[model samples]
Target: MPSADGGTTSLPPIPLALGGDDPCTAASKRTAERASWAQKSLSLPHAWKLSQGEGITVAVVGTGVSVDAPALEGRVTAVGDAGDDCVGHGTFIAGLIAAAQSKGTDFQGVAPAARVLGVRGTDERGTASVGLIAAGIRTAVDRGAQVVSVASALTTGKEELTGAVRYATKRDVLVVAPVAPDGETRPTDAPVDTYWPASAPGVLSVAGVAANGTVLRSADGAGEADLAAPGGAVVGIGPRGAGHFIAAGSSAATAFTAGAAALVRAYNPDLTAAETAKRLISSGPPTGDAARLDPYAAISVVTDGTRSPASAPEESKPLKLPVMSSTLQDRAMVVAGGMAMLVLLVAAAAVVIPRGRARGWRRP
Candidate 1:
């Protein structure tokens, strides 16, 4: 039971505010069925190295979390109540990032093993302003969260939020931005119109998609979706604090993606926030109508490539595109020549087969 914006919350300010959801791993069986297949399948995303994410903490900036939820019972670092659960938004976002499976339920996050730092920025009214958003990001960074997940976005141009993002990126922390929901707008008519931190350079902007693997209404529609996760009327703890509700919007998607990042950083302890983020963005679910989040591949890349003795990539997973390499240009030419030769052969055969052509070459 936390208090209003300036008041004391029902739970204490410590663990309730910034510690990992301390649930027992033994009690919660893993539900990531895609785990084993993720390595072999380029399109399906999966989470691996569960326990490794223990020490890392994720700072979630949104409405706030409920300290006593089953998924987060003993795991809460704070003992007393910090405040009241006004809007249910922050709790759901936190649950997506670090909630455990509770005594009886299947909902969980990409990094169930990591900790959570809840930074409340919204009130009963709506989204908070740049001053609050900047303060939240800066506080989370100072508290040592390697990954900062901002499930909320700005509607207008703001200098302070941009500065906060720049500062966080410079510190080598992975900052996740959830694409704004409908109605949260700026005057520029641009979906990203300098929308403070999310549109600010250096932050990873995440978009939402439906469960049917569509970036729009359904599979038939087309649009830009970076990494899609479960965002439909997803079930989450409610306001009185434990009731359930079906929630939507990009916030849920952003939380899931951020949790995935925590999983990568947890497994590959040697990776800096930038390299970890790169691994996540580069290899996403390859086959869906919309992109899906990839946690395992990110860990593998950072672990094998950046960590250890720092050797060249293996033959099986060779660096195919070496970023503006001369070989890349040469390969492109080779592919083009092959296509051209095939087309020429087909055209020539088409013209010569008018009469007295070989049995195999006769036009149909």
Candidate 2:
């Protein structure tokens, strides 16, 4: 079984004097309450104004998420008797995608109102076989998940997984998978073509980027990297509501992208899965280091049929009257008359200067 890393390498150090009113505790709480930088970078707030992924069901397939996590309180639903999670990687991804503000903190998920289906494809140790993961994908899709997020990438391409991907695609369910982060420490050195599920046809492969919108050094170059999103220095809820921890990897980036996809679906229920993916591609920034997600742009394209969403009305405003053709024609005539006068002056100057010079008849 290949071990999937959820990327939560370390949890921030906790202060010894932990109290609700303690300064350190208060500071930590404040940071946790603030919306994540990834969400802000993706313009999720503006996107939220259009849609909160209200009717979309996002399936998180990986290590099990803590269904009881405070931030995930009402949004998580477990499928079958999936095993418990010890690594908490799945929980963090869940939090990134759908966590809501809790305990006086303000850090809300990208699609805070979207529902999550937690499918425990991996064991307690966070390792799973190709078959298990493939099963998880199909189960999520079969259970009515509009978006299935597979947080792990494997080198060994399994027939079951490929079939599952095609199954989801044919059903118009968006399947998102992470491209293995590139580097010496990458989980698999497998060729990009062999990145199972991610390389599968119709699956959207995501890459990781830092706060400055630069692709991480460990980013996966395989799967053609469909899109990139903020992944570095990510803060998310820990297992069983322990607290928030920082993580980095393509897994987090995939979660963010999945949330963006959910927003598009929620904004326009009429958009087919293919149309939603196209909306994201059309709004996504250039790929690789400069690739950045624009959730508002993507949502607007689907909701308003434009590249950018029209600004919201401020205060009580009256609609302005449309400009009339007569007004436009008058302006055009004024401009034409000015140009005509300028041409006349220039012609007169040309004639007068040459005549004056000729009359002088002196090589001054």
Candidate 3:
């Protein structure tokens, strides 16, 4: 990956989770100073002038977030043992949402001034279940989180997780989640299917896209994605260290969309959770698959409160060509010009053919 200073370097990859018997991910000893391609694509510096996510609380529900992470110090609140991140995935997600800007690095969270609430959705080893993730959502709502970023995307537990999402919606809390789990977190042969909480109504389902605006993966079979954000080859801070880590998948995109939600909420304090989600979806530019998150536009664009067609995937219509009308005289002139050109070509060929044969077809 390239740093903000236009230098290239390698960094450790952060795993989304570990198997029950697998060891926890180690803390990264390397730091990447370059602004990740995601940061550049997001145009965060321009959006910062409008809103930095002040007075907002975003809950990260996953492998716990380490309170000691330098960029998130003094701004993170945890539920139970949620402050300890063994896999470093949750901390990395939290950093994407609200890590404060530090010296010597251009990398910063979408909402740098927002507060982070860490809620453990998985066990110490990062193994997650539907029940645990559902509980985490309800807990985050109880903790007064205005925006919840769910990192777990289970194929089952639709009934249970849908209820959890409804609970958050009733409280005016916006829930953002990945449409599918990261590739490494699920079985390689697993079929693409709906993930709970994200498939639930009123929840903002997000997919991941590379820096080039190409989707890294498709949304689950449930339905169309609400939005896409930078998730491929993304860089962020890890737990218990000043070093940075790289990760890719819709979970990271969900964190970014959650941060953008915070920005919208902070900027438009009167908007409801649904309204905030609508604002984000409406403001984003459609990329055929899903709307691409544009933080600056989400904050700056004024809407008439009506949903745009881009807010959801619609049945694509076939392109229709316009009806053409031409005068008979004009058509006749076009025909005459074609005939004149054809006659000139034939006359030239007739003059050249005999000369070429006489020269035994050799170049003159």
**What ranges in model 2 sit over 4 Å off?**
1-10, 13-33, 181-184, 188-193, 289-291, 302-364
lDDT score at residue 16, model 3, on the 0-100 scale: 72
Worst 10 residues of 2 by lDDT: 304-313
Candidate 1 has what TM-score? 0.63
lDDT of each: 0.56, 0.71, 0.85
Residue by residue across 186-222, what tens digits does model 1's lDDT show?
2244334334466666676666555444442321111
Evaluation by TM-score, superior candidate among 2 and 3: 3
Give the TM-score (vs. native) of candidate 2: 0.74
The candidate maximizing TM-score is 3
**Which residue pairs come into collision in candidate 3?**
3-34, 4-34, 4-35
Give the true-structure RMSD of model 2. Answer: 11.4
Query: Worst ten-residue run, lDDT, model 3?
Result: 305-314
Looking at candidate 1, the ten consecutive residues that score lowest on lDDT are 8-17
Ranking by lDDT: 3, 2, 1
TM-score of each: 0.63, 0.74, 0.81
Q: Candidate 3: misplaced stretches above 4 Å?
A: 1-7, 19-23, 184-190, 218-222, 305-364
